[model samples]
Target: MNQENNIVTRLGLCQRIEQLPQVDIGHYPTPLEPCPRLSEALGGPRIYIKREDCSGVAFGGNKIRQLTFTIGEAIHQNADTIVHGATTQSNHCRQAAAVAAQLGLKCYLRLSRDHKSLVQGNLLLDHLAGADVELVDAPFGPELDLVKYALADKLRSDGLRPYVIAAPQSTALAAVAFSWCIAEIHKQQQEMGIEADLIYAGSAGGTQAGLILGSKALGMKLQPVGVAPIYWEDKIDRIRQAANNAAKLLNLDFQIADDEISNTDAYIGQAYGVLTPECIQALKIVAQMEGIFLDPVYTSKAFAGLIDHIRKGKISSDQTVIFLHTGGTPALFAYNQELTDVPI
Candidate 1:
């Protein structure tokens, strides 16, 4: 498809999703700032950072886009309560609690022992926002997922309506918000006269899914790169599934293939939530060079991959690239002890 047709079809996709129930919450068209110093430091492609961090919710994130549709649907269904089961200090759950408070809906969070104590970072924010947080001894598995559902059931037994914002695999509602985001990105890049050969971001699969599907629709040869902050059993498979799920949701007649999905599990070091030396070093580079803060977990890991790719000649010097800054800055405080050795 040509640029005009691409824009038209992209708008059509956006309109179709607009017809679905949604609530307005985020600050749109988040600044796409050039990373000159960081780019010079890497001596690679010119880099631009998509500031999803300024999304303007409980500190903004890529999840705000997802929750706008997710909670919007809950509102459409007249749900009085919201439940989220996740690892301790979940950026998602923290924002969920903030959204519930803003919308006057009850919020419940089930956090595991992954982060040790619940009195810090996003957990503290969740508590202040009046979320009914339960710190359970649940391991990261199906049992924890069930624990969230059980909470919803209990609410139902008490004659209350509850909606569970499960993982992205549970539904394509979150994908809808991000599909709109890709359309926005395309417009921004067009106006800026830039072509992003590779777009890098921390991959949970869902957000990457929407970006790739949206990029495909807009006829941009943009490669959406997924950096595994933590290991998944089958990372690319999950991302491809998310892309297909998005296509199904948008009713777009396109198959998302594996070749279009670019990702790597090489950066996941210790595991989920455990930051590696490369990640910490990357965080310092961005902070020191560009005066921009990056969380120790997701964005740092993805950016570490970006830097490594540049260092390894994976990205050519003349190519244009972008790092999708999915926010998690609050989590930095949670890792104070581990980050103490890194210079401020």
Candidate 2:
């Protein structure tokens, strides 16, 4: 951490986001509560869960923090409509649509034909929000950049001022939201007398970048280990670059060096959206032990990574670990078939 940069200089994304005329849509300082059961299970460190899952949207998850900024950008651009490209169980899409509805913007969702159903979880919430749905049978690629470009083109043809909530692949805005979150975590830890040696969370990469930049900016002592639930090692660099840009947005003068960012591809399991047994077992243990529900796609996988770290002694019992509950609770329902035999 740079001592000179740590001075109370009015620099970084916090300054930039504060400059924006923003509205209050989500709750703040989400509970940083202890998880006794999970801590005991880890057998080494005192484990705490940052309850972003209780963010209180249609179904709360960590996306609310990011959505706050994303929607603010949409409003800033004076977009009358909201457009997004998402997976079938995308919590981002659900929260984006919810924000669009609350802001009185026409919401357009483009999903892959790979969707399994419409009855449960995030897809149901998308319908409940009354978003205009476009199902791209096979022409749409899974890459968000492609979907964003296609949606932008379609919106232009239809004569609507559409705002694609620029995914992390496109901009630093999403990570900027989580950077603010890291600031909050720093404050919360001091208030609670807790020192986290390791912080684990699901990463498409941007979230980790934001956490790392914010921690570095505030000069907090913790390792921001990004457990990649997707296979995009190359994008981690882009994510860090986005964090630097986000730091510029916040007016913070800190830089994220290549060595500062740590990511693990092992947590991803078979592939994106495919649930592994490790994830399944971890999810069940957390729920049964602490009565906390983690969605299969994101949080469970991250938790699995944390557990592996504990088992491998990468993190010791003397250390304190914080697992970020980057809210994907809605996606849990979408994976209902996988959880059928698992007890509540």
Index of the highest-TM-score prediction? 1
Candidate 2 residue-wise lDDT, 34-130, digit = tens: 9987788768789888988887777777777777777777787787988886677778888888988887989988877665546568888898999
Which window of 10 residues has the lowest lDDT sum in candidate 1?
1-10
RMSD of 2: 2.7
Measured against the true structure, the TM-scores of the candidates, in listed sequence, are 0.95, 0.91
RMSD vs true structure, all candidates: 1.8, 2.7
lDDT tens digits by residue: candidate 1, 56-99: 99999888888888898889899999988778868888899999
**Residue pairs with backbone atoms closer than 3 Å in model 1 (clashes):** none
Runs in model 1 deviating more than 4 A are: 1-8, 168-171
Evaluate residue 8 in candidate 1 and report its C-alpha lDDT on the 0 to 100 scale.
36
The models' CA-based lDDT, in order, is 0.84, 0.78
Alpha-carbon deviation at 29 in model 2, angstroms: 1.1
TM-score, candidate 1, is 0.95
